[model samples]
Target: MHSIHNRLFLLFLSCMMALLIIGSYLYYRSTTEIIHDKIGDMAEKNISQTAGLFDLLLEGYDSVTKSLNSNYELLRLLELRDKETNPAASANMERSITNILGAAFYSREDIIGIHVVTHKGKLYNYEKRFAGVIDPGFTDTDWFKKLKDSSGEMVWMGLYDGSVINTMQKEAVFVFGRQLYDLDTYKKIGVVFIETDPKPIWAAMSNVTISPNSRVYIANNENRIIATTEKDGVETPSFSGLPRPDSDHVIVDKSTDQLIVAAKAELADWTVFGLTPKADINAQVVEARKYLLIVVLLLVVMSTALATLISRNIASPLKLLIRQMRQVEMGNFTGTVNVNSFEEINSLVSSFNRMVHRMDELIERITLASISEKNAELQALQSQVNPHFLYNTLDMIYWMLDERENDRLGRVILALSHMFRYSSDWQEASRTTLRQELDQMRHYLTIIENRLEGRVRTEIRIDDAWLDVMLPKMTIQPIIENAVKSGLEPLNRPGLLQVYTRTTQRELCIVIEDNGIGMDERTLTELQTALSDGSSAIRGNEGHVSAANGGTAGDRAVMKRRGIGLPNVHRRIVLMFGEQYGLRIESKEGAGTTVTIAMPLPSKGRKIDEHTDR
Candidate 1:
């Protein structure tokens, strides 16, 4: 009903008036009541007190780092420079002995001393600042064995009593240590440790002034609150001061709010939580409004100016462009927005027009050209996978034929014949029993075993209960392929692959575990990207997900290639079942990997049928 220019100007005026009125009212109410004062006081305490506590937590983690560096110093001292060498007595290694002890006792005012043993069982330590020659025979210690066996450049120890560090009747502190290696030769240097005096972290919070009675509870990233002033004791995980959505500030996270918690973060990942009387927070805010009014007025003027400028510069063009956009909303593509003032907006209109024209042409051409070329490429690559599999199967059949000269070739042929027949049918991802899928996997692995000459071993634990439990068709193949192609291939050593299915607490969990060398972090990251981008945005949920392995979905559909195995398998399962059911991959270096697919078990009244393509 209104012209574009008039409507935009009116909207601009309305926004300005709203800002002014809202700002004035907020300013007046906040000033008239002193509520903001309490918030300011609480905020100040939270920032300063929490900041100190935050620094302390960081110091703890840093003490851990400095403790790690102590090991580096120890390596330089022992000249056991490489990780493999036994850390025996050495003059060069003795120079850093003080730092090693320093780091070992850095946070631990309680620890009076520390002892280390070389592989030959010789002892190392300065017994006492006053007393001399305490037996440093630190044999049969877990830290010693762990230090010797660990391959990591730096290994961190969990909490240990300071008894070893302090045999004296006096000083005792908890200790955490790390192992060090020679930078070049990769030989083991001696272990370095730091004793922690958990007191300092609490000391930082002791002075946090909150209504004279409030308390601060600190928790590390792991939700472990090392120390608390509460006499009630942190017996369980019940120390508060964490995240809460009810009040923008939470007194204690994941627990009841008998306490008002203002939670914040430190320089490190540690969460700093301060609990004050809720009455105090409300009290502080009560007196704050009077003083904050001056600030609020200035803010209101600034906000009004900002709103007007934004409206004139941004909303004005968008409003004007809306006329053209309305044409778009009306399904008109040959239209263009008026090139009034904003250069980018003018350019955007031009680009939008060009895109509309280009897209129409592309759609028409793409629809025609896509099916032939894509189908051709799919056919070729698909064949490469099938032939390689068949050759492996035939080679195995040949071996069996040689071994069992009187073999019933018919049985082997029937199995291989059914496998290829299913592979070609491509009518999978419907309802099927777990027994059938495992059968398919067995046939596939037979071909692999033929290639590996029994070097690759597989144990299929088709549990009795899961025999009739149905799953999406061919859901297990890609996971198997990924495990074999990526996980097992690098091992060079023969490995084990186990497939197990089970239902627990109403969920069907199918797990495939392999003992082959697992992928590194970079490979996992790639796999994640491949999985996430498998299905792109389409008009509805019924669109196809291209399984271009190791490729991201994008406007650059030109070279889009998704992996068929994992992505396709994951999509089919999730689409058939619900999103709660999906593939989960876990792997560690040299430790192998486990891929688990989880889905809801079928209901009693339900029956599974292959969901045919529409």
Candidate 2:
């Protein structure tokens, strides 16, 4: 979760997907509306053109009806037929009427037949050859009555399977008729009916098809579907449910699953309606959506790839910089971050490099100054101890030589020579092993035992295993020397000094305990307080060393004449290790004093030289 690459990739991907989804939705919405509107408009225009074509065809039919109705010769024959009484003469007049009807039928090729019925019940018919004979009840038919009722106006009788006046003429026909009148008298003499093939009307409706599944219908004023392109038994919508037709403009109704485009034909009481299923209408839109989806998918893939690449580009350099920073934290400041990346990241890396370099320099300077300070303090403390200790040792040897102690003279000189050699050499190391410190202490004790003539005694009970532990040079010598002067020298009885080692889980302790008259509580408290106050290791001892008995000022002066005391040793140990490891003193008036030096437990083969100046 802390990985920057994953975070950046997810952030970029989410933003891109959101934009793509919103943009696609908006574009698709607008496109669908535009396509739907365009398709509807095209269908309406097609249906309107078909209606206009039907108007032309109907106009031709109307002209044919007018020519026959207004012909003077045809009217003269009809009048002659009505006036004649003889059967043979009336038959000839009938033939003359038949010739006139035959000529009118031949004038128009679409016309299937022409029939004229006089007001006196005589009929003249001219029709296709082999057409069926006329029906005897033709005058009693609804179409004939409608024609009679028309006052010289044409009446359209829609479509029929055969001629209205002829029986068994099974070809579909479009029929229309008008009452014939004598122009001068303005009187109706008879009704004329013309039958034409309905194929041209059907072609007009079919020619404007918008789709393969589209159905075209010719609906009348009453919304009855008179003609349609749909096959029989195919389900069709109720025309009454469609919007009312307007002759001046096309109307589109989308109340159903089909797209309905309708317009009224100019010359007839008919509306041409085109119905196309919505599925077919939106097929193009579906295809467009498919392509759009493909494009979106491709874009998404590209966006993901780009996001991953950018995240990696930005995060890779930052990760490298973090690794370098961690190395610095581990005290390895030598490494520098180097990468080719964006300008901002490069700048950050440059700043980090500069910081590492500056830190390395500052730490080196601080370490040098600390080491100088520690060396100066060690030199000062060593200077304070050597003069007083050397004088005391030399004076003891002078006394021994004066008393003519010839037998022990060589041993005392040998011990004094070793002590001077060990203490005066400050060029090498300022620390020594516990075994070496103990050996030096043994040499000093031997001299003390000889001087006091067995009045003072010493016991060293350190384990051989702890002999290899390292501590500061002169660490044990001063503490043992101070114990001999302050506690054992004033003893009225034989004095005993013991040195032993103790161990805990985290630290090792060197306990130097002496059987002598110990200091009082006030002195012990003052000594402890001096240790806690971080007393300087090389400071003068006027206030630090208190008298061992009765807290006398002369005793304090005598102690001052001695070497550096436990407080300076405690200060040195605390500086070398940390504050947690230091010196603790337990002493009671008239009882023995125990000075326990506490130090860290170093692992096997561990070197502590680096902490000498700490």
lDDT of each: 0.55, 0.78
Winning model by lDDT: 2
Cα lDDT of model 2 by residue, 1-614, tens digit? 67999999999999999999999999888889998899988888888889999889889888888998888988988988899899999888888788878887888789998888888887877888545777888788887898999997667777887778777788888888899999989888898888998999888888767778889888787776667788778887787878767778889877788898889887878888898999997898998899899999999999999999999999999999999988988999899999999999999999999989978866764564356335544544455456447756766775777578675764666576567667766567667789999988987887788888888888889988788787767778767766777778888899988999999987889998987788787778777787787555423343224223223456665544334455556655765676787788788888878888888876556664334334
Per-residue accuracy of model 1 over 430-496 as CA lDDT, tens digit each:
4567788888888778656766666778888766766776665667765675566555644568878
For TM-score, the strongest prediction is 2
Off by over 4 Å in 1: 1-381, 384-415, 427-431, 535-563, 604-614
Compute each candidate's TM-score over C-alphas.
Answer: 0.31, 0.59
Candidate 2's clash total is: 0
The TM-score obtained by model 1 is 0.31
lDDT of 2: 0.78
